[model samples]
Target chain A: MTNPGIRDDDVLKAAEQWRREGRGVAIATVVQTWGSAPRPVGSHLVIDDKQNFLGSVSGGCIEGEVIVNAGEVIESGKPRLLEFGVADETAWRAGLSCGGNIRIYVQRVD
Target chain B: MRLDLLADLNAERAARRGAVVVTDLADGSQRMLRENEAASDALLKSLNVRLRGSKSGVHEHGGKKFFVELHRPPLRIVVTGAVHVSQAMAPMAKLLGYDIVIIDPRDAFATPARFPDVQLIVGWPDNALPSLALDPWTAFAAITHDPKIDNPALKLALDAGCFYVGALGSKKTHARRVEALKQMGVSEAKIASIHAPIGLDIGALSPPEIALAILAEITLYLRKGEEASA
Candidate 1:
């Protein structure tokens, strides 16, 4: 697995701290990737209800989508599996600039 | 992810230990496992390859999908002997991304002037290693050439299951050292695991060259040993 982010230690801690502060938090993790994916598997991008984020699951690509999805997961209390690729039309809005595919898992921090 | 589980994981990483969260993709159910706990779960053979490793990915087990997310500390090296080779090895190992440390009880040898750039512990390994909490991420080398200093350290390193355990000594010296370790309660299997004449045989003759050889050997074990399959 590739780890290009320096915030491996910070991302999770930030999520926990935000939870302690009574903020709604959801975590997005790159569960799988295929070919030239920006981030390696297990990379995290934690999002709070205010749209604040720390770390990256696909560098800059697709994080907006994951964050948006995390909002629903946070409210619904149901985990969501998201797949993003340059080939997907909706993902094209924030499509992977690297022309790779990534699978992310988003879950609320309860 | 449960808040309590995330807190536990953060605690493990903060303490520089390894922990894992196994997520059942079929239902989003999760459980945490420490490195020691993962060892005896014979069914986790696929997960064992990743103990003390930094990786998060999905795996198929028993026809089900499980995501194994690991939180591991950075790779480290602990050398017992603030000798000339360690002085050279400190910087080299640092460049290779290892958190290197030197331990020697002799203040005369482990002075800051000699090992200015590394974590030099001026105390016996008997007193120091327990705090370091040697894990598989660490590579250990004993080069004091003094059995009084290196022997006890070697016993501890072997017991810790360090990724690489090497010692600097001659064939005759290692032969005697092996007996000493056996009497000290180190298993024959564990004692046999030491890279006795230590380092890859590029016919290293100087301290720096020996350091290079040892670092190369450590790199070999780091990349091609247990983590190779990973």
Candidate 2:
């Protein structure tokens, strides 16, 4: 099996490659976590202009929202710090019902 | 951040040199620092401690927060014998995210049928080890139970500063091996580094069990130290 860190490296490389190909790319990274977050801090999800993504920040709990926000970041060229937790009303809708909290930082890379 | 920095980071990783990518969170600027460089002494010292532990995390220094991403070379295991224990150990090591290389001069024992999906060197230790270039990320296992095969490899592993060196032998056998290493000009300190009667004392009897014990001991040494569980 491949190491998780190596897989993260692949995400970085893919993000750089997408940017070099003139596709808008944004990298969403898990900067902090509390309680039972599935993936640890430093985990990354790379998204491109075509809504394609590589790697993951959460275990299918928050990727859709992050991807939608990443689209806006790519269009505006502004970074964002997003927070999600069980206390939020959208947590149940987004499936983050595991009673954990996470902070993700998203930024465009070119 | 410049794309060339990413290229250089990839180059460092490909060369098996440890590096750290320090990202200034406030500005999103990133700089790659090789382990040996001295440009950022204070930050490098902090980064070196994290790198040695093989961990990556955020750190605060000088009122600024930076994400220190460590890029360490993959851990490696070099088995000097293609014995039954090795057959079991190689795949287990792979499962634990280790790169394995099996070295044995015996054509019959070192056949691909015995060890598949692993790098095999059909040469003696003295010939194969130089190219393997054992380093701190490497663990060396000598299990042929032959003086001609195991001794030279242990010596080379000691010289190369392999993190773990293990040999399969009983207590008496290890005592004699120690004397032989002394005759070959190895110091007491270096000879003490060898984990003879290799593996943790888990009362392992079968080959696979012994492989598990050995891997456990190697992991303990890598994470902790000889003082903790040798």
Candidate 3:
């Protein structure tokens, strides 16, 4: 699923604030969703101040993936896309079913 | 953590944290204000009119930025059709965080017994589309195979500027639909907006599969708009 307008607006707001404050902020978005997915496109799930987050990419399957990669995002302060689905069985154990896929894009605000 | 006081003024009461741009002009202003100080004054003026309890931060650019936040409503989806595909679609759309409303003219098709969580509408598309008030934020799907119902509904939705307008049918069926719409004087550009054979070609055949595909397409359209703005 993609991120919604309001959610993206929130993330943008947060990111800009982080930039002003000189603190790194990472924005994660569910850009693509497949069969039986939990969240829609434009679903905003913001991760900052460690793993503290707002929004959801999946039921819970992809949060850890987001969290794990957040550190890199925090360091790089650039956007990245992470994909999870049946193709990645390791991701399935995280919570999603077979055939369901999601593309999460992460960007650092600060 | 600093509170987003400007958000409170925007009537965002849900405590969903967000930020607001403290612009110097109201939404309807046509010309840009020339002076930075003048713009700031205008923004302060507008904020006083539309929002309440707002504190502003002045920036080097002279544009005020306030970190205001409030909860947003759940995404809404309006599905027109009580067909089997819609049966799978309503719940599926909900699972993806959409507040689903199903509109079908057939009383038997729009029964609450069939779709318990759906906001069921047992009215013709002509009446239903207006009452629903499809917004740019709303996603609409017309899955009814009957063009008589789907056409009027589509015309209204397109005119209303719904973000996504998709319909179910094969390419041939969609081409015929285009002809019908053209005869109705809908511009070719407007008629072209319909995502015919609605859904990404994930090779769907079953009702559930078709619903999944349609939802995927909707998701794509929604995301594309978000990313463009970002």
Strongest candidate by DockQ = 1
On lDDT, the stronger of 2 and 3 is: 2
Off by over 4 Å in 3: A1-110, B1-73, B226-230
Alpha-carbon error at B184 in model 3, in Å?
Answer: 2.0
Give the Cα error of residue B210 in candidate 3, in Å. Answer: 0.7
How accurate locally is residue B214 in candidate 3, as Cα lDDT from 0 to 100? 88
Off by over 4 Å in 2: A1-6, A97-99, B38-40, B44-48, B226-230
Per-residue CA lDDT of candidate 1, range A1-110, in tens? 12423557788999999999999999998899988998878888899999999989876978888988999988998998899988888877787878888999999999
RMSD of each: 3.9, 2.9, 12.8
By lDDT rank, best first, the candidates go 1, 2, 3
Error of 2 at A105 (Å): 3.3
* lDDT digits (tens) for residues B37-96 of candidate 2: 633557867655456644566678889877777777778899989999999999899888
DockQ order, best first, reads: 1, 2, 3
Candidate 3 retains true contacts at a fraction of 0.00
lDDT of 3 by residue, B26-68 (tens): 1211121222332345544554421212222222234533221
Worst 10 residues of 2 chain B by lDDT: B46-55
lDDT of 3 at B201: 93
| Candidates in descending TM-score order | 2, 1, 3
Model 1 Cα lDDT, one tens digit per residue, B1-230: 89999999999888878887888988999998887776665546654545644356788888988888876767889999999999999988877768899999989998999888678899988999999998777899999999998999999998989989999999999999999999998999999889979999999999999999999998888767855323
Collision count for each candidate, in order: 0, 0, 17
Give chain B TM-scores in order.
Answer: 0.81, 0.93, 0.71
